[model samples]
Target: MDPLTIGILGFCALFVLLFIRMPVGTSMMLVGAVGIYMIRPQASLPVLAGEIFGEASNYSLTILPLFILMGNLAGVSGMSRDLYNAAHSWFGHLKGGLASATIVGCAGFSSLSGSSLAAALTMGRVSLPEMQRFGYDNGLATGAIAAGGTLGILIPPSAGFVVYAILTEESIGRLFMAGVVPGVLLTALFITAIWLIVRRKPEKAPQSVTAEPVSKRMASLGRAFWIIGIIVLTIGGIYTGVFSAVEAAGVGAFLALIVTVIRGAASWENIRDVSLQTLKSTGTVFLILFGAFVFKTFVGFTGIPFRLTGWVEAQGFGPTAVVITILVAYIVLGTFLEGFAILVLTVPLVQPILQSLGVDLVWFGVLIVIVLEMALISPPVGINVFVVKGIADNVPLNTIFRGIWPFWFAMLLAAVLILVFPQIALLLPNTMFG
Candidate 1:
């Protein structure tokens, strides 16, 4: 069989294995190994060994574990609770204010954590009960937290973008810079959607402000300084070239640990729990990354990605049309796959096609993240929704799904903005990295 045909078969087989409930990492590694063996029997074993070793030893990949540790530390440090309190005190007086505060709090936590599940689960636990106590509609309360959690990925230090940068050989710093504008824009759009929904149906978000003195509000805000300091130091340092991506991650993790320890949040028990959770999360990410590395090698050996790009280019489609098709494919696949898996599986193949079409990689990266953001809140297997559901068990699943509709629309709008004005995504990266 031709290399292209072999590649196609391998791709299909990988997905089939995934559909059968096989582990994603194992499935990809299995397909990739077999494909490589078929393509070049003499070199397959040695190449597979080298690929595994190289992928495992990569220094850039160490950033993943550090970032995960930072997030886990922040979660255990009780930072989310302070952030939620600060947001609630400022916004809780208005209709749907608690929901708005939830979104804002999630965004803040995302800046420190850089994991959607962490942000969603942490914020949901901290804010859901408060929103419920205030008589906020269950749908709005749960849905806002779930949808807002996606900011964790779109914001900087994003694990998804880190993986993409490593796979594509793009500048991680540039990719991180590219996310800032779009992240803030999406956050604003989500807040707007909540405001509009509440305005149209005030009954859905009845407000109940506690009679707290201004002194109490100021005190609550004081507790959030650690979160603010960590974000500013991490993001600001990276953008200014004062720190490399890995250095920033390490610094952030250290600061988080110190703050947790100083505040008495990181006891022996808390440290044990955080360490174990971080290890589990880090291991899962690295395993999948190794699988993707092997799969990409197989695809390259088969020459499938090149042929597919050629075939698509020969179809007489314009650049816009081709880009549209790729985005649509991501949306469909996203319904069933996790965001990281989808990114790993498709980016190696899609990126060359995009480069050939004169598209900007940084801009495209931001756009792809927006699409992945949608997947985070979509039904069936949306991880964010599941996180929220797990935290707020009494709220029916359907209500959470129903509440996410407006945010979904808002996300679509954000995607369109990135598409129509690529500058929105590219400006910061270009200005900073040029």
Candidate 2:
């Protein structure tokens, strides 16, 4: 069979494996190995083993475990609760204020945790019950948490970004830097959407707050300064070249551990728990990454990505149109696939097409992340939505979906903004790395 035909069959087989409930990493690795053996029988096994080992052992990949450890440590330390309380004190008095605070709190927690499920589950446990007690709409309450949780991937220290960086050979630090402004912009857009919704139908969000003393509010903010300090030390250190991305992860993890211990949050038992959780999450990511490496290598050997890119370039679509098409494809796949699955499956195919079109890879990276963020909150398999639903069992799944619409719209707005003004994504990386 022609390499193109073999490539198509291999991908089809991978999808079939995915449909049969095979683990994504295993499915990809299996298909990739078979495809490689088919294409070059003599060298396939050794090549696959070497690629897997090389990809798995990269120093840059070490950041994944450390950042995840930092997030787990922060969770155990009860920092998210303090941050949520601080957000509520400031915004809880406004119409739809509790929901607004939930979104804000999620963004703050995303900055710390860098994992959508962690952000959603953590904040849902902390905020949902309070919103329920205040008579907030179930949809709004759940939606805010679900949607806001997606910021975990777009903000710095993002595991998804790390994976993307590793897959594309982009600078992890530059990609992390690229995310900051876009992340803040998306968060602001979500907040604005909530404000607009409440403004339009004030009855939807009835506010009931016993105002805290100003002193108490000040104290709440004071206690949350650790989040600010961690962000500055970790991200600021990266941008300033004080540490490489992996070292920044270590710095953040160490700082988070120190703060958690100082606050009496991280006992030996808690440390044990954090270590186990980090190991599980990190292992999962690395396994998937290794599979992706094998699959991408197969695709490269098959010449599929090159042929596809050349074909697309020949079709003469405008760069903007082609970019939109890729994003639309993500939305469709996102309905069923997890964000990481989509990233691993499509990035190799998409990156070459993007580069051939003369689009900036870093800008495209940020844009792809925004689309993946939407997928995280999308229905059915929207992981973050289910996470919030699991936390607030009484809240219907449909209600959670309903609540995420405004935030979804906000994400769309943010995507358009980035699409139109690539500078939002590019400025930070260029300014720092140039």
Winning candidate number (lDDT):
2
| TM of each candidate vs. truth | 0.97, 0.97
Stretches of candidate 1 exceeding 4 Å from the true structure: 210-216
Per-residue alpha-carbon lDDT of model 1 for 110-208, expressed as tens digits? 887778889899998888888888788998888899998999988988887888888898888899889989998998999899999998998888867
lDDT of 2 by residue, 1-434 (tens): 88889999998999899988898998988999999999999768987798788977788888888888888888888888888999999889888889888888988888777898888888888998998898887888888888888999999889889999989999989999999999989988988988898888877788769677899889989988897678788889888889998898898899999999899977889989999999999888888988998899889988988988889978988899999999999988988988999999999998898888888888998988998999998877888888887898887788789888898889988999999999999998899999
Worst 10 residues of 2 by lDDT: 202-211
Q: What stretches of model 2 exceed 4 Å from their correct place?
A: 210-214
In order of listing, the candidates' clash counts read 0, 0
